[model samples]
Target: MREELLISRRGFMLAGGAALAAAARAGGGPAAGGVPNVVLCMTDDQGWGDVSYNGLKAIRTPALDAMAAAGLRFNRFYAGAPLCSPTRGSVLTGRHPNRYGCFMPGSPIRAQEMTIAQALRRAGYRTGHFGKWHLNGVSGPGKPIAADDPLSPGKMGFDEWLSVSNYFDTDWTFSRKGELEKHVGDGSDVIVAEALKFIAAAVREGRPFLAVIWFGSPHSPHKPLPEDQKAAGGSAYYGELVAVDRAMGRLRSELRALGVADNTLVWFNSDNGATPAGSNGPLRGHKATLWEGGIRVPGIIEWPAGIRKPATTDVPACTSDIYPTVLELAKVTVPNQITPLDGLSLVPLIEGRMERRAAPIAFWHNPARAGGQLNTATGHAALCDNRYKLHRLPDGNWQLYDLVEDISEKRDLAAEKPEIVQQMKTELLRWIDSVAASYRGEDYRRAGIPFAPATRPAGPATAPAARPRRQQRQQARRRRQ
Candidate 1:
């Protein structure tokens, strides 16, 4: 009799309001077991201590500070790679960028790999992508990518997008669903405004949505609005960040005004560490290095309906976890058995049930070879467990640090604990071997998959001078074009 009554109630709901029916079909609304909307906001080169909440004294980020106070913040969060494109790929696939040939910036993500957007779209979610889209290999500064570009967000399952192939500044042109559109304002504000339009429409239709907003501020050639530049006390770099902070504030307040703030999951972080203009706290090294300063980034997630209490955790997490966590929340599964994923879902941690990470995080940065090309002798690699982290430099020298005791990685403990060093070395090598196998195309069912060799464009190089001639040429050509 109870089962019959429950069935009758469900039938009544299905036959009631059109909004309720749409919500039920979209896995939203109270009767359908409320599916939360998702918003992922990532900055270009902001670092671990770039925000005021993390003790940054140079600039103020009241919006982000407020988010840290009202949400779950991550003290030891990391980017998937030390660079932009690779880390973005990991965020979409929950796999290392090398697994799919996105080794560094300007490298395009392979179309064969399944993406989070694709999975969510199958689950009845409206997907939109905004702001920087460096995953496509249109390498100059920023430009509107061709509509038919294989790596565009449309091909990655995003239903709508207003994006640039790379970073943008003030008064930049954006590709709106593959068509060029001009916007006048701060770049960060422009993207957030477009994303809000999509979100508002989804809410009006009672549909769950996934909005990915990638900011192109605080990056090289920093160009902040005049007002923001003045607000930053005349520092162009800090001025760019001021624009980003203001945009973030607008995004949060607009969501609340739309009445979806409580049910929306807004996750914010940086793609990697800082540039020369930013700070990575006390850690050593910066972008392009496999050190704590390169990968460690500020991370926060606000989901009032799910995470009832605001909190912070030091448990290690990375951008790669985004894909799996979203899948877990949407209750979706991949249609095919893909390669082994390096990221684990963070749902357990979000629910306060997890005390430790299930697996250690691994990072490899080798720009000399293409993604998935195994050249252990040519690049830097690091493996970090809960306490100990081992770094293998290009010269084959190994350095070990206990992160808990040395958050800044100032002290090397390799000589003091040889046993732990050997143990970690063995584990790290084993993992590297697996990654090498995947790099050899062993993970793909078909062979001869083409990889676009890194190209050099004709222009003054913005990257390090040590970069190979091929990459320099690629950058030069991109500039000339």
Candidate 2:
């Protein structure tokens, strides 16, 4: 029965892909209407209050503030997960990271997943990834990936790339199309410099391009240039962010100089919430938890051709939405149903038709080792709509918050609204079950694609376990302290 079910699903996917291809041929893709160039820029470990425009008094992000003033700004944008790798995977696949077994940082995305770059390239766009590429597992910072590494950006459908395995600092060594190359100056400046080269070449040839620039600054071991450091008022972390802000100013200016700024779609956000050096605004918790502070970050989109007037929306959005949103805007179709997508296209929202999100967003994070194997019985999960949020902790305790009324999550309303809590909990559990099924290899058994095991080997099965309620309460108390 299981084998038969897999075959049936695969058949449906193939038929779907064929239909999409037929539609593309009938419409001639985005070229018929002139596709706008796409540029996706994400910072590492920056926070909701990191940008000067978002009310960060200490750090000045003039470039970001200007972009927000000139384009569509998102007031409630979120990362797919609380960590780096999982959120990055969501940006590419339009699906929750747990669906593909990318449960934590350093976990490798499975080879079978189809990425946004692959889909865009199929639609006649030159795809390039510059800066950090942490979807592939790396041992440490500044290490080179082997040419044969299955998870390299090239294999993931990038035509050209200058990337690092993890966070890199100034004068760091990076892999350029699989060759090690040393670069000087700040890491953010270096990556953007390389990306501009690729973009310039694409423009010279008159080709629409999709450039993914993932910055490595402000993550950890904060190192900033002398001038930027001095400007940061003695804080190395804040200094690093200053350099990122300067880099953004340079990128936007270069886009105008190249005459593509009008037609280019520049979208900016962070991979996760703030580090200790940064602030999450009025929200609770930090980078590793499911609190608003950990997952919510700054989001902005600038496209002079599409958005004539600047505006800001409070409709909740996430990194997973990037893939579907780009595809819809470019008129590109996914050749197949790669997996169950957790994101919805924000075209309607961008056009000012959507007042609220039709679908809720979910996040999951299981406590796992660096090798990606689940270690404890502990995990974190949450579900959110426009107003309310439901959080499920490892000890089977539930907490509910009205995000609109209390963004800080200082009040818990689980007891006051049991009916709403039960309804949300039911839905959250059902989604969790589906994700578990996908994690067990049910989603990859298409007719032609072989199933690949997760990067971390599973340990022997253990009976379901939960910490005692008393101990759980103590841990929660400690967290509060």
Model 1: which ten-residue window has the lowest total lDDT?
1-10
True lDDT of residue 407, candidate 2: 93
In candidate 2, what are the lDDT values of residues 1-481, reduced to their tens digit?
Answer: 0111112223423443444334333332122258889999999999999998888988799999999999999999999999888999999999998877887778778878889999999988899998888877543454444345678888899999888778887877667666666666788877777777677667765678899999997988888888788998888888889989987987887777677788889999999999788988887988988999999999999998889889999999999999999999999887666778899999998887999999999988874443423333347889999999999987879999999999999999999999999999998888887777667667777425677555533321111111143346669889999
Best by TM-score: 1
lDDT of 2 at 337: 68
Candidate 1: regions farther than 4 A off:
1-33, 367-372, 446-481
Per-residue error for 476 in candidate 1, Å, reads: 7.9
TM-score of each: 0.87, 0.86
lDDT over C-alpha atoms for residue 330 of model 2: 91
Candidate 1 CA-lDDT value: 0.80
TM-score of 2: 0.86
lDDT tens string, model 1, 1-481? Answer: 0111111222322332344334334443321247778999999999888999888988899999999999989999999999999999999999888766678888877776778899999889999999998887656677765556667788889999988878999877677766666676688877887787777668767788999999998898988889899998898988999989988997887777677788889999999999767899898889888888899999999988889998899899999899999888888887663577889999999899888998999887863554536665567888888898998888889999999999988899999999988988888788777767666656655443443433322232222221355476779989999
lDDT of each: 0.80, 0.81
RMSD of 1: 10.2
